[model samples]
Target: MVRERKYLGAETNAPVSIICNCCCKRCARKRQRRCLPPEIIFNILLHLPALVIRDVMRHVCREWNLMIRSPYFIHHHLRNSIGGIIIQPLFLAGKSTYVVMRRGCLEISEFDCGFAYAIRTSCNGLTLIPDSRDIYTLYVINPLMKQRTALPPFPHTVDIHSEFKLAFVEASMEYKVVNARGPKPLNPPKQIAMLTIGVDRVWRHIDVQHLPLTARTALTTFPLVTGGYVHWIGETFVLTLSAETETFCEFPMPQLERGFRKFLPMDGNLSVVYCSNELSRDVWEMDSETGEWTMLLSFDLKPLLHRFKDLFSNEKSVTYLGWLAVREVLVLSTICFQRHCIAYNVKTGEIQSFELGTDCSNTKPKVYNFVAHKNSLVCLEGGF
Candidate 1:
């Protein structure tokens, strides 16, 4: 063929052009066949660690950066995310220490916050940390992202064994912080403060006059937030607030004065946990839609608490902190003098204890709190 074309150079040029055109068409077809859909790309990236998404994958290209920060991606990441137990020791717990036990692993990680704040509760990957020096000064921090939002201070001191809460308002699709400052024996804040994240420039004060007189006398330590409402233990009843309507609802909890009763959010419903010195633990679930409370899980902590009795003093107490939903483990803090973390398996009925630290001060605990923490790349309009 070459010998025949050697004498016809002009004819060979057309054949060469035809071959080049056919090669270009084949390359185009290959590119089209190999290109992946956006949905498939999203699913593939979802399995990667949040650190990879924020640091490595996002920087790979502009399209990736946009998708990683998108709302849908953030929402789905949160939905599939697994949370761990975050522990704050009482003494240095206020200032520096944070102990984290991640899910599906036994290894413990501890780090210093490099500041002073009593970490109280976590909701949707953010924690409500109130300053230990000034109880009214509050901050919402995403420890995993190393982002912090210092909320405006309250007008006065919230001194009555206060508990702060971070909750979401479904109607506005915004996060809200509630002071939940329980009443002190001496002075009680006339009005409670509420702040709408990324919306309210300053703290919004709501009067407590409409609330029951007992509301001023006592406030619960644990607050359950679902949708737009936040529920807390009042002096003698359960107090709920609609963050959207700014209205209030009050209901009575089961009358149990002998045990350390705390409110827990469990199984998409509100749960009440009562741990007594009598070595018994009762978990009651309440239908979120209906205000009905039903006793479902009752377990004897004798076998579970017996093995860890050496960790606490004779006057030791057991408090059910919160449930680890993905792991089916109930977090309990056993404290007589020092605090020890005990995880109770709901299915296996087995318990494992963890010490916060090995040092002497770590053994003698203070007013620390433990909450479920999920490391998420939840980008908000607000600074956090």
Candidate 2:
């Protein structure tokens, strides 16, 4: 007969056979078998999705609880994870909301955040959001684990035009939130406050130099992390912020066709999508080493004319979200008739559409924010 083993360092599949009563007695008299080796357990757990590990496996026992919480496991998990999209709909007047829609899943899991007007970009699976009740107060949250911590309020009133950015610093293994606000983009921000949570609760100002002439233009978009730098797309150039060094570098963007331009993080670099002439679109990738741009794919909305005539008729254009490398599909959103998205296959010219269901009617802002995300065990604790 076989019984469960709980001793550490034990082989997971090895069983001691007791053929006779004497052998059984001797086995029982001897020290109990050691539990499974940590290496073997780690290998087994590494294959499970982050949701399973966070919700199910972590609750199995004390050993598992500690294993999942360990820094080693967390780093590995965050590195290998492929995240879904975090959808935050800006309704007219209702409770602020957040939800995650994993690719290939029809239903979404909602994360409760009390009435908040803005949902900041996510970094390593954690999102920083301003509390609706008090816009000055911020909450850093891991929706998958339902873990959250509030940040100390800003010394001065937080501006509505200010942008919030979350980033993971590898050197210190910490998460930092940057609040950048200014009346114009070309000029340096009036105030740039940064806080490294868990290490210091106080916010400190960052001294930025070599400002871009275009900085005077107000920034309406959030920052994206890729290739070890946090990037913000400006009118003339892309602003790159080093996560480790906390410094800024500017790179010029490829000339566009005078339509719509968007920057998305993909394949470890910045991917740019520019739409022009109302129907023609081009997708390019920037080389991190040489700063060269490469055209990966192009799209013609002519084929979509038959199915999505409403889009072309009303002059509504497509918004490039991100790419699904594993599936080789391009993600895009549109608001021609209503809020919806299209998944266009790169290898094969196939297209599918999905309704985002954001209830844009009667909303004051009438806009929704969407971002590509992956679940990570990047801990919110510890300091640099």
Q: Estimate each model's TM-score.
A: 0.75, 0.76
lDDT of 2 by residue, 278-342 (tens): 77667788765346778877777667666777664533555666765433566666653335666
Model 2: residues >4 Å from true position, as ranges?
A: 1-40, 92-107, 111-118, 182-187, 215-222, 255-257, 276-278, 287-292, 310-316, 324-327, 336-338, 357-366, 381-384
Writing each residue's lDDT as its tens digit, candidate 1 over 1-384 gives 323334334655656546567878999999779978889989988877565677788887778778878878877877666556566655453332333334543445664443465455667777776666665667677766677777876655665323566777655668887775634424554676788987888878888876666765443344666545677666567677777777677767766676577677763467876775466667777666556778767677666656766654332366567776532578777554435677777656766767565555544447665656666787554322
**Residue range with the least summed lDDT across 10 consecutive positions in model 1:** 93-102
lDDT of each: 0.64, 0.64
Judge candidate 1 against the unseen true structure and give its global Cα lDDT, from 0 to 1.
0.64
RMSD of each: 6.6, 6.9
Ten residues in sequence with the least summed lDDT for candidate 2: 92-101
TM value for model 2: 0.76
Query: What does the lDDT come to for candidate 2?
Result: 0.64
